[model samples]
Target: MTAQHGHTADRATTAPPVTTAAAARDYARSVVRQRWDSASRTAREEDVVDLLLVVSELVTNAIRHGDGLAAFEVALAEDGVRLTVHDNSDAVPDVAYGRGELPSGGHGQGYGWPLIIRLAREVVIEPRPGGGKSISVLVPLHARP
Candidate 1:
């Protein structure tokens, strides 16, 4: 990502796309590190973990239900980190609950979205203008600070 207008923005890492679940989480982690690594150097470690975990969950979901692998953008705005993942899936997510065990492959199972709603400042999904889906998740810098 080039330094534009003195601000670091989320850049599209590549074209084509990543199709594997493992590759998706790895890509998400890379974006988190590139964006949060800077100011996080002075912030608490827990905050960093929270952001990375959230990113992993969102990215994994996109890869699984959507078409092929997608892309994630992590931007360090003045207020907090803005994480957006774009996928080719048309499925919109909803809340579901059960008593079974968590899925071994997915990021979180057994109704883990509420955990995200509790941890993240904001979680939203909207239909992309063209043909896909986009999920935007905002995580605060620190819960205490």
Candidate 2:
């Protein structure tokens, strides 16, 4: 959410408010790269890709499904990156809150939630204080060999 550990107060760490999925992805990539570049080891390419996918899916869902993107935050952790996406809807996806099963029937939909569940850890969906929901996840990043 807000800057922590006295890190530099910049968009790279907190990100300016974004509306499109592409903008969110760009912001997330910058955050990941900035954090990993300054760390002891580099993040694996595949892991970064996974993180980007998750970022896109979440932001896209918020804008497309949820009313609209309310707030977006990305923070770096010791072993992974933390994402908190807020939307202007209170409805939480059944797949995300109920069972972590991928939708069976092919409908061109319901794939993003499953992909998010598969790639992210500590996934949480909670209703916001006002009238929306916040989805948070930790996407783990491994060091390159």
Candidate 3:
């Protein structure tokens, strides 16, 4: 990260391509963890935990539901961490807002949607021109003034 006019600029990172759903989660978590660990300052313990969880959920969803994890980006902003996952599938995800497990028993993977929605301060889903979608989530690191 570089300093811009005295304030620290957001640090962004992209993980290497992962082949499987489990690999996606593992790789994303490691990238996020390593980046922050090497930074000048450390994030709060709770924030770090939340970040890991968010990363796992998003990457897992991308690999499981979409064509695959096309790309993953992590940005450390002034206020929080932003994670974006892109997949090659055009199908939109069903955003579950309320509490309850997925209908497909423990084997199902959709349970992450509700948790992602609840943890993220903001969520945005965008469609690619060719065919695919990207989901972005911002997880706050500090309380707003």
Candidate 4:
């Protein structure tokens, strides 16, 4: 999917569309780096690590479980980093959007959602206009001393 822009002004700093999870992580790291470099208070290294993990989980889920990734965007917000991942499926995992519960089964395949829930805030899942859905979340960045 094409990148969705809320305002034309943001287009200049907006990251290009990424298809793979690795690309998404790289783009997200660059954003964090840019923000840290420019801001007086940089995000803690641990917080940045958490942000990368969340980015990986979101993009990987979209590509693996949500048909395929439609689009991906990472923006530096005042309080934290905002991530939006659009996929070609409308399905939303109940464990993620519902009670924020972890999967009960013993299978080793259900950690991503819980990990995301623990690391991110204001998690939202909404259906896109044409098709598929968009998952958005804010991974708060803590300032380092």
| TM-score of every candidate relative to the true structure | 0.63, 0.85, 0.72, 0.83
**Which pairs of residues clash in candidate 1, taking residues 3 or more apart in a chain or in different chains?**
18-69
Residues 1-145 of candidate 2: C-alpha lDDT, one tens digit per residue: 4323344333325569798888988998887776554545777889989999999999999998899999899877767788889999998876784444666677534779878988999998889998999899989887777
Ranking by TM-score: 2, 4, 3, 1
CA deviation > 4 Å runs, candidate 1: 1-41, 96-109, 143-145
Give the per-residue lDDT of model 1 (tens digit) for 50-113: 7667766666677676663356666555445777788888777654222324456656643455
Best model number under lDDT: 2
Better of 2 and 3 by lDDT: 2
Lowest summed lDDT over 10 consecutive residues: which window, candidate 2? 3-12
Write candidate 4's Cα lDDT for 59-137 as tens digits: 9999899999988887666667888898999888867865556667785458898899899999989999989999989
Q: Model 3, 74-142: lDDT tens per residue?
A: 776665678888889888765633443454655644568777766787788889778899888888664
lDDT of 3 at 32: 43
Candidate 3 worst ten-residue window by lDDT: 1-10
Ordered list by lDDT, greatest first: 2, 4, 3, 1
Judged by lDDT against the true structure, how good is candidate 4?
0.78
Tell me the lDDT of model 1 at 47. Answer: 69
lDDT value, candidate 2, whole model: 0.80
Comparing 1 and 4 by lDDT, which wins? 4
RMSD in order of candidates: 6.0, 4.1, 4.5, 5.4
